[model samples]
Target chain A: MAEAEQVKVLRFWASPWSFRVELALKLKGVPHEKVEEDLANKSPLLLASNPIHKKIPVLLHNGKAIPESLIILEYIDETWTDNPILPKAPHERGMARFWSRFIDDKCVGACWMSCWTEGETQQMFMEQARACLRILDDELGGRRFFGGESIGLVDISASFFALWLGVLQEVAGISLINGDEFPNLCRWIEGFVASDVVTECLPPRDKLLAVFQSKKQAILATKSMVY
Target chain B: MAEAEQVKVLRFWASPWSFRVELALKLKGVPHEKVEEDLANKSPLLLASNPIHKKIPVLLHNGKAIPESLIILEYIDETWTDNPILPKAPHERGMARFWSRFIDDKCVGACWMSCWTEGETQQMFMEQARACLRILDDELGGRRFFGGESIGLVDISASFFALWLGVLQEVAGISLINGDEFPNLCRWIEGFVASDVVTECLPPRDKLLAVFQSKKQAILATKSMVY
Candidate 1:
């Protein structure tokens, strides 16, 4: 019998989910190939890997495709058990999942400023989004990272909040992730940015900002035309 | 110390999530006191149990409130090992979680339908909800339950779709879950209803319909005022 092949990740460079998966793989010391995807003209492999989601950050492990960035993280943590992402205690594990699911529910799913037709609908969502961040800030009170000291799974999963939120605030002409207001969370962001592992793995903030700028510009152009 | 105290469940009569926790407790043979909540004016305990959602189906085991219906299900299954809802295998368990999460994401979350305004929104959600039920029908094709012949944790978790969906469809004045279109699903619904254990525990359809009627009327009244 031949040895099984290693897992491969199909990802998009600009996607924060792609970055999170990359960070998890790196933390676990899992060696795998990364195939960058072009969202404009999606690769057949990417489409085949995740026909349902049809998005990036699809991990092909031993030829079996696992879509959903969070799902991929779980797979990585499970397969490469050396560096554990989940807690040992079942209750603690559940709590970690609570936070992860919270991020997915609050931060990721609900769009704030984007696609808001009016100031009210958009502002309401924006305020709600800010409120959610406030909860995170409180939860991260006095802690170096969401994991307390070192960067842990929840911190890794929320890496997007640190990167994209700031950029989005800039593009949308509003500040949500204010360091002064959320001292603990802000410090955590700084710590994560300065960390060697995170710094090395992170996609350039300027590049991300450029992408956000272009997206907003395109949206604005379309809005002008339609109006 | 007297080996700690047993957990109690605070629930509403007509809620499917409440029934899910109850079914798990009944299956596990765990002793619990049920606290019925007034939907009109929620109790303090209910509010304390789930501050975020402020909804029913809160499982209070060992005096600690566990909110989120699925999280509550996981807790009940974990605390009592009589009949495990989740499999020991990580992969199998992940698949179960994936499907459960999918239901929450696609159907339970009201993803597709929530976007539309009146008229179209009602029809859209109905169709989407039907598609979801049809998918379940296919999953249950030629099978007794979702977990195979005998109902398992997933089966209990998904039981809501059978009854509540029908009620919601009627309330919205749209038809989906067409019995002819979903033979297996219809059979599964009957199979669940036929099970003495489940049948005995369920609330009367007329009562449930009354509950939904009141809720739907309240929402429509509020929306009409707003518009």
Candidate 2:
């Protein structure tokens, strides 16, 4: 498995999912070529590589494209095998994988939850999202990180709360990840951003805020246009 | 590692997630014991095993319990050096995982989209669910199965869609898994149900449909009572 040819990753600049793959590659200390995809006009290579989702954070190891951010993380962890992302014990590893998947499934697109719903409906899902955060914060619960001690796979998987999308609370006008409320998660976020790996890879705070502003505007525009 | 004891899994009756672990176990031909959880009150063992979710299916390899359906699936594949549920190729394996996670994330509650919402709100989520199903159907286009040829982890992972909750479509008065539109998927479903591993483990369809019906009615009754 160690021919060790250079790796290539197709990614979007502002996507949290893309950020996940980027963080993994950097943590594993793997050298990778990054190709950014345009959402409006996707590249042919991106399309060909990921014909199904036709989305970004597709890792090409020796010219084969792998879609899905979590999958990419797993792939990176397996390939490098040092500074292991997932726990070694099969069941422990499974617990980590489950939570990571839960985050991706339940919380990954929460920034978009408000965008996708309105009135009472939005309120319902928003409450559901808060409960998810509460559970996550509980999961963090005095731990230095989700992996505990060193920031590992699940922490990287959930770094969205640590980075850009966290600012969406302002844009969406929801205060879910409150520091006083989710004390452990708040500390976890601080530790995550403070880490050398995260600080290096994270987009500038102002830039991320601007992205959130634009996305919020777009979402409002979607509803506005519908009306 | 070679001397590690065989794995065992804690599970619940009528849990699709448990079914997920079961299928993965059978597919991989992993040597394991299945401990069924009593959801009526929950067992102390189950509580200790999955203190977080207090749920099943939890995978125990060498006496550690791993919670969450998807995570257990990964653990089974990893621990058992038998038939691999995940692919040997890293990226391809990621794709399998990604799809499985997508199914896990999007397939909420067996049948109903929203028990509370009425008119446009429910309609919107219904559209979203349709979009998801459309994507899954397209991804499974022209293939013998989701895994291609033989049933793999993804097929086992998503088997709930075919057997258990497929009846929920009847309960919901919505038929998203249309045989005519998704002919390949329909064929795959039939093939899966006919398979020995899948067939032996499936809850009787009549029982499943009855439970789903009772559950749906309960949801409706609870909503009505609240109003």
**What does candidate 1 score on TM?**
0.87
Which 10-residue window in model 2 chain B sums to the lowest lDDT? B108-117
Q: Candidate 2 DockQ category?
A: medium
Task: Please compute DockQ, using alpha carbons, for every candidate against the native two-chain complex.
Answer: 0.32, 0.64
**lDDT by residue for model 1 over B95-134, one digit each (tens)?**
5666676677776645224322367776676667666766
Which candidate has the highest lDDT of all? 2
**Model 2, C-alpha of A124: deviation from truth (Å):** 7.2
TM-score of chain A of 2: 0.91
- What's the residue-level lDDT of B55 in candidate 1? 75
What is the lDDT for A47 in model 2?
91
Backbone clashes for every candidate come to: 0, 0
Off by over 4 Å in 1: A109-118, A219-227, B1-4, B109-118, B171-173, B222-227
lDDT scores of the candidates, listed in order: 0.72, 0.75
Q: Could you tell me how far off, in angstroms, the CA of residue B218 lies in candidate 1 after the best superposition?
A: 1.0
Native contacts recovered, each model: 0.00, 0.97
TM-score of chain B in each prediction = 0.86, 0.87
